[model samples]
Target: MEDLRGAFAIVTGAAQGLGYAIARAYAQEGMRLALMDVQAERLAQVADELNAQGGDALPLVVDLADAADTERAAAQALAHFGTPRVLVHNAAILINRPFSELTLADWQREVNVILQAAFLLTKAVWPLMVTAGRGSLVYVSSMSGIKGFVNESAYCTAKHGLEGFMKCMALEGRPHNIAANTITPGMYMHTPMSERNYPDELKQKWVDPMLLTPAFVFLARQDATGVTGERLNAWELSTNPPA
Candidate 1:
């Protein structure tokens, strides 16, 4: 893999959870980062922590459900850091409401965070990556991406669309040496979302999200020739990256 020291990265949902872990991992690699999240105070705390560790960190608060906000944040990152070596769209919200109980607003909120923001962010980065001749794109996906679940129609639909989007981008990215891929945690994680939604059985099996950051660090160094289009399992790749 190429050296990522001083390289740029953009990570969404970076205030906490897997996104936080990924940002920490990238900082360890000596990468500069733009950390985007909806939680302003928490996001600022995260940036301060990384910055104190001798990392260059920028915090951008954004409500990704709003297109204009999403576009503005993406523009800010690009304006500040130029083209990023990797862009990780890790932000998503899962509200478990039965189809009967779901409101259109709730549906839109979940879908927009997972799918719409992915598009706007990727679209913003596409030209820069193409001009730079290489970049990596990672969309955090889950089992919902490929399978249906009760009380997760909106979340599932968005995840499903995210994976499909990655595939198409991967194909388009090939000639430019850009890589686009989706990754599943492949293990129950001890994140706020999982804490709220996990069954007792799965919570017992949950691992720290930090344990999965190795997979993301690996993804950050990729170009189309290394990996693209596949749905990767973080547990497997983090433990044993391919030679």
Candidate 2:
């Protein structure tokens, strides 16, 4: 595995849930972090905690749904830590409503956060990665990307788009030594968002978000020669790492 110590990583939606877990894991590896989230207060709290633990972290408050905000966040991150070796596009919004009830506004909101933001952020960071000739771009995907689910029209569509986008990135980034891939948690976790949608009983049966961190860490450390354009299951990767 590549050494992560002293490397810079940018993780979006890092104020809570899987994003927070990914940031925490990176901090433990002694990696410097740029943590972005729409929640300013919570993002600050996470950064503070990491700093207290002797980790280098910067909190960037941003609404990914806004193109300008996404661009600004990327610029701030690059300014703080030039050309992050790892970029995790984990910011997303889920609007669960029946197909008939979903409005154009709801669909647009979901698509902006889940798809457009990824494009903008990646575009912002692309030149830096090319200059470095080594970088990892990880899209936090879901089963919804591959399978349709009721009441998740917007989310599923966005994720499906993300999957295709990552593949194109992988192909284009090959010559530059930038690896782009997708990782699916494959099980529900007891996150703040999930708690709002899942019953306590159901949440108890789901895997911990932390369990999915290994795959992320692994991908971050890898170069383009490693793995790209692949959809990996976090749960399986955590149990048995790819050879």
**Using TM-score as the measure, which candidate wins?**
1
For candidate 2, the TM-score is: 0.97
Per-residue alpha-carbon lDDT of candidate 1 for residues 1-243, written as tens digits (9 for 90 to 100): 678999999999999999999999999999999999999999999999999999999999999999999999999999999999999999999989999999999999999999999999999999999999999999999999999999999999999999999999999999999999999999889999998998899988999999999999889989998989999999999988777
lDDT for each residue of candidate 2 in 40-92, tens digit (9 for 90 to 100): 99999999999999999999999998899889989999998998898999988
Looking at model 1, the pairs that clash are: none
Identify the leading candidate in terms of lDDT: 1
Q: Which stretches of candidate 1 lie over 4 Å from their true place?
A: none
Residue 138, model 1: Cα distance from true site in angstroms: 0.5
Model 2 misplacement above 4 A: 199-201
> TM-scores for all candidates?
0.99, 0.97
Candidate 1 TM-score to native = 0.99
